[model samples]
Every structure is written in structure tokens, then in C-alpha cells.
Target: MDGQVNRVPDGGFGWVIVAAVAIINMTNQSILSVFGQLFGGELRRMNEDTFTAALITNLNSLALNFSGLFIGPAIKSFKPRNVAICGCLFVSLGLLICSMATESWHFIVGYSFFVGFGLGLISPSTFMAINSYFSSKRGRAVGVSLAGAGVGQVFMPHVVRYFLDNYDFQIAVLAMAMVSLTGIFGAMFLKPLNPPLQHNNRKHIRLLSEKDVEKCQVTPQAETVHQPSEESFSKKMLSRLVQALDLELLKDFVFWSIIVGMALVYTATINFTMIFPSFLRHSVDLNSQLVATCMSVVAFADIICRLLLPCLTDYLRIPYRVVFLLGTLGLFVARMFLAETKDLRVIIAMSVLTGMMKSATVINNNLTISSHCRSEKLAGGLGLSMMSKGLIVITVGQLLGWIRDYFDSYVICLYAQSVILFLVVIVWSPEIYYRYRRQKRTTTKSIETTIEAGVEEVAKLNA
Candidate 1:
């Protein structure tokens, strides 16, 4: 929303963007979350040990992450939608292969590596590509895009559950394969805001030579057509990455505060989203379908927040920092209350509040990050922020799971998470006032410069 426009706004078939991203996000995320359910079942059927099963899942997570470093470049090089379509193809193929897998290594190599690799390529590309269409309303745009993940979370388990119940595990994998392949068709429709920068160095050289021959001599016009040198290309890449990330933001205090706060928020957020279904089922005797539906309700609530909050933000002129604080606080209270009660209603209530709170934090953080970014650096900065959060999520999610196992209950873990959020707020409180002071100083300098310019103009007139 901060930079460019996608043809046809949200009212038209732009809604397709939401559907496409939702399918992609859902399939990408289910690689870990929904697959966690299949781990034990497949291991048992194959008579393999738990370690081998765990290895498969771990490999998937690792592949999903490290592959991003390269795949992100591919998206920029070609186009996001094309890359996403290819990624979906791989995901679909990998899933189909996984369905026929007969050994532990089959999944370790097939499902974990290949499928995960495809997702790492597709997921972030779609998110970054979609942003070109909604600069001023990027929060809502990102929300719509990210809501796909929520929708995936909502349905994947139930889809898995249906297969596990009605069919066998293999059929379920086939269904996922079909779903991911459908994602390929959806990705085909994505129109990137920026034209892919062509790098046809050899082609450029040939054109220069042809131009020279046509003129019967070397000419300055032909020289202009010569391919840029390799060194120049490398420099261009470095510059592009830097511009994409908006490295100028490192000079601003608020940016650092946001990075730290967002990381803390990620710690709490990933654990809850991943753990909630299992926690509820264990305590409340709900079916996976019910859990999926309940989570969908949360996703819908979150969608509302994503849509409404930005409109409210612009109208109220409220600082996004305050919005961040409020969202974090809501999450803290939800977690604390959740820990205190076993009543199903209470848990459901916590889920609703948690959804809105998480939504708020995301919407505000995105807006702030965009504010810090220069136009050129938008994609790179967003990727950097996401990379940071992704790393933190992997680390903290594992730690929380360990802590929960140690305590035999999730309550203490939630309490510790609440305390962490509280500390994050306290430490970062100065960021708000920092922005306030910078704005005042800028305004004062502009006023003084204007007055001086007016006096000089009058002196010239009098002379």
C-alpha cells in the first residue's frame, strides 16, 4: 500500500488474490502443523522409531527456512507469480510422492525436503508480490494476504482429520497434493507491480554488435547498448537488496524498538497458534473438525480487525506504536486468563481475543515497517523483518514446547510469555516519544527556514 498499485482494487477480482494466497499459505503451513499429526501414525505403520519421524518434520522446517534465502532472489529475478506457480508444482508433486512413500527415508527425502523446498519459494513471493496493489491500505492488504495462513490453520487439521477418519493417511496426502496443484493455477493470476528486471547480458552484447555493423562503424549509440559488465551487475544486485530493505532505517530509533518488540511478539504468537489445537483437544474432548471451525471463527475475527484497524488508525491519527501496545496487552491478558481457566467457554473466549490481539500487532507492525522503508527497499525490508521473526519463532517455539513438557501443563509457559510481553513494552516505551520529538524538531526547522526565505525575498523586492 505504501508503494504501487495492483490493477483492479479489492472490490473486484482482487478477492482472488486473497483466495490464492490463502491456498498457498494453508498448504505451506500445513507442511509442519498438520503433518505433525501424521508423524506418529506413519512411523507406526512403517514400524519406524519416533526419532526418524521427528527427523522428517525437522527437515521440513529447515528446508522451509534456508531455501528462502535463494528462492526470494528467484522471485525478484523472474516474477513472483511464475515462481509461485513452479513452487506449487513441486509441492503438489512432493505430496503425491509422499502418499506412496513406504519407508521413513521416503518421507525424509520426499515430503520433508522437496515439498518444503517448494513452499519456501512460493510463500514469501506471494506475500511481497501482493503488496504492490495497496500502498495506503497495506495493513489491510497484508492482513488479507496473511489471513490465508489463518484460513489454512482453520481448515488443514479438519481436512487431515477427515482423511484420517474416512480414508487412510495416504489419501489425505493426495488431497493435499491436489490442493497445492490448484494453488499453481491461482498463482498464475498474480500480477507483480514491478516489471521483472531483465538480465540478458549476452543478448545485449549481440545487439550492440549488430548496431555497430548496421552503421558501418562503431558509434556512441552502439556503445550505449553494450551489456553492463559483471561487476556492474553485482553492484546493481547489492544496491537493489539494500534499497529493498531500506537500510536507512537503521539510523532511526523507532525501527530498532519495533524489531525487538516484533520478535517478542513472534515468540508468543507462534507457540499459541501451533499449540492451541492440541491443548484444546486434550482438555476439552473436541474433535479436529470442531477445532478447525473454532479456529476459522478466530480467523474471521482477525480479518475484521485487519480491515477495521487501518481505517480507524487513519481517522484517529493515533500512533501505530500505541496500537502495538494495546494489541500486545490484549494478548497478555488473553494468555493469562486462558491459563487460569479450564472451562471451554473461557478457552473459546481467549481464542477470540487472542485472534484480534495478534491481528492488531501484525497490522501495526507492518504499517510501521512500511513507514521506515523507502520506496525501493520495501520488499527487502519486509523480507528481512519476516526472516527475523521466522528465526525467532523456530527457536522460541521449540523452547516453549520443552518448557510445557517439563511443567506437564501449558499454564506456566503462558505466564512466562505474558511477562516477556510486559518487559518488551516497558523497554520500548521511549520509541513513541522518540518519534514525537523528531517530528517537532523537523516542523520547527521548516518554519524557521520559511521565515528566513520570506525576509530574503522582501529584501530583494525593496532593493
Candidate 2:
């Protein structure tokens, strides 16, 4: 596309967007996604229905995942900042309304729908914007950007813990509303970019017969920024969606292997933070501040992982596929240690290690998709992966909640989770090697083609 600013500014406003978006995302993500863990006490107070209380989280998650489908194309259509601003409005209002809800359904329909709707605005566009704004530093920038979620993981629990302990759930909801509004304003700074998405349609010109590039002479103009009209994707979009997702992905042994591996391990690991707080409240006789402090420790650990792991990947000479398999090993140790739980020190260690390992999971999966797919469609492919991962998290959330309630011991769920993580670790090993070899071969062939092309040019000159 024309008029794209793909390079990161040396040291000016681009860095500012990173900080601003980070705060906005941290606040917004905490407000919407982690409500289950944070507001457990509040939801129970209002509804006396853990299931319905949880529905608020579940529905929000479903909407968050579903919105990815629409948000991708929207990136090309609307300016990134506009999409972000719209999302902020949806979430800020959702939180404010939740403070007034008298019933579970009110919270669900209002809080979940609107908040999910808002986050939908923010989530998909966040990475795409950073990718546009920052060129050389994308992985680090994205790592830093998405690390906002872990930042939320670090503080929001304690924030929720504080309000629940002191004032009431309404105050907590209202405070988070204020936090969400920050994102609304932050979205103002996002100047959209036309990223260099390589068009593969040359071989499929028949599919896009409406436009003739050779005759058209694409004039560098502002019109390029406008999104296509309402019916833009109306023709064959369903097929394109299917083809883009490429469920044949599931058929490929590596794809299925990676999906199952990521899903099971991630599903098991997602709930440790939520459950750990309750476990502390139950086992240790600790006050809310102590619990929040401990949670903060885990959050800091997550921040370290987010920062360190990306640097590790970049400098690491090994194939990332192998690194991903090795990385999941951290989860196994973390889970098993938590299950033992003979002492508080062990508990803390397990929590920190889990945070570190989960951060690796985030980086590895992005690496996985980046390696497999073409650059242009990577975002959409990633969206589909998120859709699957989100669904897995929802099921795991409910299951973890059930396990916590049923066994009355967080360790049991922790142990069960360890088993799943390890199973995935074992399953992913061979597949990781397969992908490593495939990419290696592909690289070798591309190098050979370049060498041959140069040789042919030399031969023709000699003739």
C-alpha cells in the first residue's frame, strides 16, 4: 500500500504511543478480561450465583474472541485510532453501567457485551498498529505492548482485592471505568500506516479480476486510506474466511500437533493466578494486602518473563520451534511444584515460574505462526489462533473454577494441570523438529535459487 510509515521513529512520538497504548491496554484488559478472578467476591455478592457471575467473564471472552473475525478487515478500512476510540467508549460505559446492575443478566448483557465490544475494538488493532509504527523493533515492541496484559495481571487483582476488602464491588467497578476511559483518549494518538503486505494474488489474478494493476498506475493518493464500502467482502467472503483460516491447518500433522499442544498447556496454566489468591485466603490465614503483595510478586515475575523472553528469542541461535518445546518445560516444573505446596515459599516460586513460562508461551506461538504463514495474512492467521485459544481459556476457566470448588484444594487442580502441560510438552516435541527441518530446507532452497539466478545472469552476459 501507498503512504505507509512502516519504520519505527528513532526516538520521538512512536515511543510515546508504545507507553500510552501500554497503559490503556493494561487498564482496559484488566477491566474486561480478568474480571472473573478480580471480581469473584463482587459477583458472588450481587448474584449469589457463581455460575452467572462467571458468565460475565465467559460472555466477555466469547465476544472478545469473535470480534477478531471482524476487526482484521476493519484495520484496512477504518483508521486504527478511530477503531480504538470506539472500543474505549464501549468499555468505559460498560464498566460505569456495571456499577448500577442489580441483576446477573444486567451485568452479563451490559458489562460483558459492551466491554467485550470495546476490547474487541482495541485488541486486534493494537499489534497491527505497533507493527506499522515500529519496523526494526516490532517483536520487542509487540512483546512490550502485549506485556500490558501481564501488567494487568500484576496489579488489578490487588486493586480488586482492595476495593472488595474496603468499600464495595461498585467502587471497584467505577474505578476500573475510569481506567478504561484512559484507553479512549490514548487511541487519539494512533496514526494509521499502510503496511507492506506482499500481494500473492499474482497467481490468483482470476480471483481479483475487477482491477487491472498494469493499466491502473496506482497514483499515490489519500484515497488509498479509505476502507472499502459496507459490502466490501460480501462476495465469496465466507469461502475466503475458510480458505484463510485453512482448516487444512488441522489436517497437517504439525498444525494439529501445535494446536493441541498449545491449547492443553495454556488451558491448564490460565487459572493459576485466580485460584492462587483463593488458595492463600483458605490455607495461609493471610490478609488481603499480603495476598495482593504475593500476587504482585507473581505479576513482577510475569513482567520479567515478558521482557527477558523476547530478548532471549531474538539472540537465541536455535530454531524457535525447538525453543518453544523447551520453553513449555518451565510450565511443567511450575505446576508440579505448586501442587506439592508444602510451604508458602514453594507456592510463591511456582507462581513466579508459571508466569515466566506463560510469557514464553505467548512469544512462541507468535513465532510459530510467523514462521508458517505469509506475512500479509499473519494477522488473520493469528486471529484464528486467538479465537481457538480464547475458546480454550473459557472452558478452562469454568473447569478450573469447578475444580477449585469441588476439591476445595487448589493443589489438586494444579496437579491435574501439570499433567496436561506435560502431556502437551511430550506431544509437541517431534512436531517441533519436523517444523524446524521444514523451515531449514525452505531457507536452503531460497538461497540456492538466488545463487542460481546470479549464475544464469553471468552466463547470459558471457554468451
Candidate 3:
């Protein structure tokens, strides 16, 4: 196995990993999506202000993404399976703590920090597993895995609402804790591939072989080499640390563009979803039932797109970046329509479009990064992308709220989000075009050169 080249199965057990990841995603997202339903009444009864509630939510997101800074090292040290299992335990424990909490700060400590950090671990581990297992079908596999989130979003609310209706808050939270434990079973399936999919592992083998050869050549009486100075040793250690973290990815223009574009699209789309109900009820003067219907439509549409869009794109052989760009542009158009319309039917249509476009963006977020990174560096790329997203969300997320407060309008917020999407489209559109043209020109020149060489060889044979 050490001498053999690493090759992705692209099927078989890879599909099992996909299923396991999907279940993990479903379990994690079910708990996360229903946070409001689980804790909203309790927080209100405790006399917590909306600002405090918002802070709790923001803290959760902050912890989830900021923790990415450590995930690469964690996965490298402990392996994905162990990391995922530990994450499951952390989430379960956090929920147990949340069930017993009596204060806002308690909820913050239990739910926001603990559960958020757990999710941070589980997410990237599962993602890395999927990327390791498949190559040709990666787009479809990612879509299928992330569809679990949509499934949780669509159905978990009813399940949580049932518990909230039948039992006390603590009992419902306790039930959720038990539900979280199922992810441990899923995590157990994350076995490392034999021979592994990483080139670095093969490189290490070659290095060891070279050392063996050197040992064979050296004489028994050779003097031992002196150790390096402390300063040089420290510099070497620092360089290794930087390489492990893949900090060099930050120096790449393409990588930077991908992370920034994803961060902006994610910030805009997610924040919009968060405030969509408010927009519908207050700005559109929609009734409660209609608002609920709109939300349901969005969820259904989102899940359907998640299940189908990536598969369709892969079958069509469209580049992930191109699909991502189209999604962003579609989002910009959808938001513009949504902001301009007051009709219920038009709003519903826009909601569907928003869901579909958002699904495209979500499916391709990591796909784009994986396309750019080698197998070994994938973990670092994903971690850094998450870190960037966390920073942007923490800062710009606050600004979105401020824009709403300053204008006293959700409509203005919608416009701001559209502008964000437009900016991403502007940044990426020209780059994608330029790259396509350059590749085409290179191909054309190669074909012309080959033809001229063939003609010259035939003429020499005739002579």
C-alpha cells in the first residue's frame, strides 16, 4: 500500500461516507435550526431583551467559525473520526447544560460557545471526509450531504414544536440532547482511507526511503552531526507550523477571491433569511399564516434545489465557480424583485428563487475551494475559508442590523444585501472570463503546433 499510488474510489464505500455525513449534517442542523423555537419563550419569560437574544445568536456563529482556526491542527493530530465523535459529545453536553440554565449568560455559555464549537469540529471533519472519498462525483456528493441541512430545516421545526407543546422546556431540550447522540454513530464511519488520498503521505514515504538509503551508505564509525542552534531550530519549527496551517493559501489571489466572495454571499443570504419573516409581516403587511407559508415555501424550495442542482450541474460539466457566480447573480435579481414587490404571489415566487439560488451558493461554497487546493491542503483551505467567513460575518452582520435600525426598514436591508451580491459578481465575473479565455488560447496554440509538426514529418518522409 505504501508503494501504490493513492486513488479515489469515487464510489462504493465513498457513498457510505456520504450517507454518514448526511446523517451527521441532519442531526447537527436539526438542533441548530430550531434554536428559536427551543429557547425563544424561555428567554422572553426571563425578561431578556431582543438585543441580548441577538447577541447569543451572534456569539454562536462567532464561535462556530472562529474555532476553524484550530480545526486543521485538531484533525491532523486526532483524526477526523475522533474529532467528530468528540464534537457530538460536546453538543450533547451543551444541550444538557442549556436545559438546566436559569440565566441568559448560562444559555450563552452552554448553547453558544460549547455547541457552536462542537458544530465547528463536526462540519469540517465531515466535509474533509467527503472530499477525501470522491472526486468525479464531488459536486453531487456535497449536494447530497448538505441536503441534510435542508431536510432538518424543513422538518425539525415541527418536531421541536411538538416537544415544546407537549413537554416543559427542559424536557424538550433533554430530548434534543439525546437526538444529538445519534451523530456519534455517524462519526464512527469516518475511517481514514487506506494509503490515504493525500500526496504528502506518499512524499513522507519517499523521504523515509531516502533516509534508509543514507543509512545503508553511512559507516558505523561516522561522527554524529551537531544539532542546530536554538534560533535556527525555532525558525524551522515556525516554518513547519505555517505549512501545516496552510497559511500560504492566503497569498493566493484565487483563494482570497473565493473566500471573500463566499463570505459576502453567505453573509447576505443568511442574514436575509434571518429577517425574512419580519420583512414579510411588517413591511409586506402579511398575516401570520401567510408569513408561515412563505417560510415553508423557501425551505421546500431550498431542499429540492440542494438535492438536484449540483447533480444537474455536474452532469452538465459546468465549472463550480460558474455555477456559484450564476447563483450570486440570481440572488441579486431575486432580492431586487422581492424588495420591489408587495403582491403575495410575486413574493412567493421570489421566495422560491431565493431558495434555489441560496442552495446553489451553499453547495458550491467548499467545492470551489476544494477545486483549487490539493488533497493534503484541503483541510487548511476549508479552515481558513471558515475563519474568513467568521470575521466578515461578525463585522458585517452587525452592520446589517444597524442599516435596518437606521432606515427603520427591512426593504432597505434587502437593497443592501443585493448590493453585496452585485459586488461579488463584479469581482469574480471578469476573473472567470479571463481564465477561460487564457485556457482556450493555450489549447489552440498547442493544437496548431502539433499540426505543423505532423505536416513537416510527412514532407520529410516523402523526400
19 Cα displacement, candidate 2 (Å): 2.1
Which portions of model 2 show Cα errors greater than 4 Å?
1-14, 32-47, 133-136, 152-172, 195-237, 240-260, 280-293, 317-324, 363-367, 394-409, 438-463
Clash numbers, per candidate: 7, 0, 0
How high is the lDDT of residue 318 in model 1?
A: 68
**Cα RMSD, each candidate:** 6.6, 8.3, 4.9
- Report residue 318 deviation for candidate 3 (angstroms): 0.9
Q: Ranking by TM-score, best first? A: 3, 2, 1
Candidate 1 lDDT by residue in tens digits, 47-141: 88856765676567667655645553465556678778888887888888888888878887777888877877776677656655555455556
For model 2, give the 10-residue run with minimal summed lDDT: 1-10
Model 1: weakest 10-residue lDDT segment is 1-10
lDDT of 3 by residue, 228-331 (tens): 34565557556656766888888889889999889989889768978999999999999999999999898888889988998899889888889999999999
Looking at model 1, residue 282 earns an lDDT score of 70
| True-structure lDDT of candidate 3 | 0.85
Q: Give the CA lDDT, 0 to 100, for residue 4 in model 3.
A: 18
Q: What is the Cα-based lDDT of residue 48 in candidate 2?
A: 63
What's the C-alpha lDDT at position 448 in model 2?
100
Q: Write the per-residue lDDT of candidate 2 for residues 27-48, one digit (tens) a residue.
A: 8876654576555666667646
